[model samples]
Target: MFFSVIIPTYNRLPILKKCLTALEHQSNHNSVENYEVILVDDGSTDGTLKWLQDHQLEFPHVRWFCQTHQGPAAARNLGVQQAEGDTIIFIDSDLVVTENFLKAHATALIQASKISDRVFTYGRVINTCNFEYPTAEPYKITDFSAAYFATGNVAIARHWLIEAGLFDTQFHLYGWEDLELGVRLKKLGLTLIKCPDAVGYHWHPPFALEQLPNLIEREIQRGRMGVLFYQKHPSLEVKLMIQMTILHQVLWGILSVGGRLNERTMAGVLQWLINQGKPQLALEIARIFLNWYNVRAVYAAYREL
Candidate 1:
């Protein structure tokens, strides 16, 4: 199977370098005829396009396109339009994979296609903060995901995406774009096949107190996008996914003390956890307030509509 790996990147040049380098070094597989990496730069101010152009020879498998700071949904649509391969692999620019990454996906996909073409391969993503040795990090329980169609590490036939109408451009915010497409794909009777051998180490900076503002803002954006997702599908599943139900409101409200235990109120405790070399733990704890912000924002957006 010829695969087009669609990666949407922003100002994440440092990890994007590692991500592209890993893709270029994938092991040969008979099931995989060839593969190309399509890097769509979402108008990054970090000179991502220039750096790629300068080191073009280093990543011969890579072809890049640029947009004017559009969100990932639009960038991915552009990549799919430029893709020539029959299969499309969607991954973020921060995810660095092992040498057999494509081979694993190709092998699994080819096997699944025999059973039915209505199948997509979902890979494992291990989150890590170790930039220097990202792949060295072992899998953690917190890294486990139950998402049906997260764009972090997934592969499907290109035609299926076209059939589903690609991603909605209205999801110009932070989240729900991929899963919204998944909803459409589900209606098309697509089955998700787990491909755990295809592993990708998702790298991000270690949690810090200073990053809370940006993280909080991201949750808010996710909440707004959640409303857009619900508007399209308007299903019970979408309501649960977006945390728009009364149960979500009560759960987060009680956990966060009705928004009383916010970033400002919990800053000292979060910093203490960070100081104790447990940034991941700190981030999990901070999610209490972060999710509160998201739930509140979701209701606010729904009310506005």
Candidate 2:
């Protein structure tokens, strides 16, 4: 089957380079007839478009489009509209995959299709901060995800996405656009088949105090978008996912000591963790306040509605 790898990128040029390079070197396999990398630039100011243009020959399979910072939902819709492949693979620009990634997805998809066409393949995503050697990072327990349909690394039939109405452009924020689309796909009786062989190393800068502001802002945006998700689905599951329920409120409240143990109050402990060479642990600890911020933002947005 032919595959169209649709990647929506913002200001992640460094890792985007590695992501594209890895896609460029996919192993030749019988499962895939051919593939194209559709890199959608979400109006990045960091010269992503120009860099791609200059190195066009290096990534021969890559075709790129640009939009006016419309967010990943819109960017992906544009990619799907332009894609010629029957199958669509969605991945973030920061994820670098192995050489057998496409073959693994194609193999899994072909096998699943024999049973039912209403199936999609979800690949593995291992998060790492080692920019110099992202692929070398081993899979950790924290890398495990239970998401039904996250765009981080997933492949599906192009027709199914069109049938599911693609992503909701109303979610023009940091999160939930994918899971919202997943809810629609579920309504269409789509089944998710896990494809562990198709691995992608998700790269991000190591957690630090300096990144707290942006991280916190992302959680706030995610909360706002979560409200939008609930507006679309409005199920108990959606409510729980967005942390709109009182359980979430009390849980995060108690963990964060009723918002008293915030980024400021926990700065010393987080910094100490970071200094101990445990940035991941520090980030996990910081999630107490981060999730509290998200819960508060979710309620605030719901109230506004």
Compared with the true structure, all predictions reach lDDT values of: 0.95, 0.95
- Write model 2 residue lDDT over 22-98, tens digit each, in one string: 99999999889999999999999998988998999999999999999999999999999999999999999999999
TM-scores of the models, in the given order?
0.99, 0.99
What is the per-residue lDDT of model 1 for residues 197-232, given as tens digits with 9 covering 90 to 100?
999999999999899899999999999999999999
- The lDDT of model 1 is 0.95
List where candidate 1 sits over 4 angstroms from the true fold.
none
Clashing pairs in 2: none
Candidate 2 residue spans exceeding 4 A from truth: none
